[model samples]
Target: MKLARIYNVQFGKRIVTVKPDWLRVKAPQWERVGNVKEILRDLTLNTVCEEASCPNIGECFKAGTATFLIMGPACTRACPYCDIDFEKKPKALDPTEPARLAEAVRRLKLNHVVITSVNRDDLPDGGASQFIRCVEAVRTISPQTTIEVLIPDLCGHWEALELIVQGQPEVLNHNTETVPRLYRRVRPQGNYERTMELLQRSRQIAPWIYTKSGIMVGLGETNEEVRQVMRDLRAVDCDILTIGQYLQPSQKHLKVDDFITPEQFAAWKAFGEELGFLQVVSSPLTRSSYHAEEVRGLMERYPRQKVIN
Candidate 1:
């Protein structure tokens, strides 16, 4: 794919360069999107698709899929690269959220679902109890639906992580977000070592649950740096990886250091596969939970024995 040269674009009051043609997303069926949104609204649920302003929201919603953002939309940490709102003292957890989320899953008839959350650092267990409740609710309402939880580091609370692992979601994902070198700049509140330890411990706690992590490019990290992150993830036996170009969410957020090419993404995909990642989704528009439903097929191919703890 030929990269479209720099073109001045208007983002609110700021003039930033527009994304290349290869990154452009075709309009989705709004009617389908509306149907999904209606279901979410009826349940009073929030999705990362709308919260984080994901570029692929339309496509995902049109396809009757969404990454459910649980807990609350307000994150405790303010990662500039992210668009999710931050709140020092977010409202208390709603006990009814789990049932409502399950109802949405049953209504959508989802074969697979991704349940993620904001960084509820205020919670002692980093909202692990809520995650467990949500998973149980989904299993009750939609027994056949496979579940994936993209969670936070839980302030390096291994016990909390073990609790989530014991819940036995088909997959557990935590995004590395960027290379270690740029951690302070890109993810000031996140710890590189903590992220790796979390994934490593997830596998240790429950090997049957697939461990997944993601990284975003265009944040001024070198290709070698990205490969290093991949190697680190593999060191923890991460099963799935996602690499995507970082599009600045707003003028106040971090600027895009570079626009990675599709060729480079393809190269990274090849590299990740060579390093033994069971699945690697690499593209300019890829996100952590993008096409998460496909994991059901992966599960069938690489079946795992559920560990009884």
Candidate 2:
């Protein structure tokens, strides 16, 4: 029996219908969304938005924004909710990927950039060095851009985490994805404690860099569970938090527990802010990289004010 059928899922008073017309206008500002696709194809690079079937891809790319996936498209882990290809033996790490990525960023003229990767548990350093190379390449090629990274847990390897932090990205993000109760269902190989530790250690190693994490609601998690996740993030001194509705990529993936209302998303955003997060983007359309420019603006403005005052 499906959970929704068995239980009367109360979505509460804030359910929002998908407004396609509004989405087209309010989406990201990719000047040439179609052109960008061709460039990515030419470089043979992959994007998480495409691979994961993220709902915000159209708006993000149309707005001239993208989250670049480095390492390779094939992942070693078969997380229940992910659509990334899973195979026993993956292709070798592309040595030229960093340079190609740098060129792509240069062409896009992106002010804020995001880089993420599939889980490469097969590698010795868990592909941390590769991530560092990509960060450095982006820095060298796009000096004016602010870079953000959404990294894997690296299976609790602090050495790998250290390498990524040393690269000096403006933001270091690793999604907790879901609450502890739903980990087995949503992210079976992930450890909730380790995920928290990754954020905690990121601050300890790179105190100046902003630490961020995101969670998806509507996976059968209760309101209290969401609150607890926020508290846990605050405990780690995470600077940013993003909450979005969970839409199942395909029928094979985990089912959508429920569709959270827009009002509920607003309530969670308010709750997160009160908990001491510097910035929170919570909505059905919110993704980790959504409104990335706003985050950079807040980070920049706060420091300048502190220095001036």
Cα RMSD (angstroms) for every candidate in the order listed: 1.8, 5.7
The estimated TM-scores of all candidates read 0.97, 0.89
> Among all windows of ten consecutive residues in candidate 1, which has the lowest summed lDDT?
1-10
Compare the candidates by lDDT and give the number of the best one: 1
Tens-digit per-residue lDDT, 1-309, candidate 1: 223356787878769787788888999889999999999999999999999999999999988999999987888999999999995468899999999999999999999999999999889999999999999999999999999999999999989998998899999999999999999999999999999999999998888999999999988898889999999999999999999989988888998878889999999999999999999999999999999999999999999999695
lDDT of 2 by residue, 93-201 (tens): 9999999998889988889889999999999988999999998999999999988999999999999999888888888999999999989878989999999999999
* lDDT scores in order: 0.93, 0.84
Question: In candidate 1, which residue pairs clash?
Answer: none
Superposition TM-score, candidate 1 onto the true structure: 0.97
Stretches off by above 4 angstroms in model 1 are 1-5, 9-13
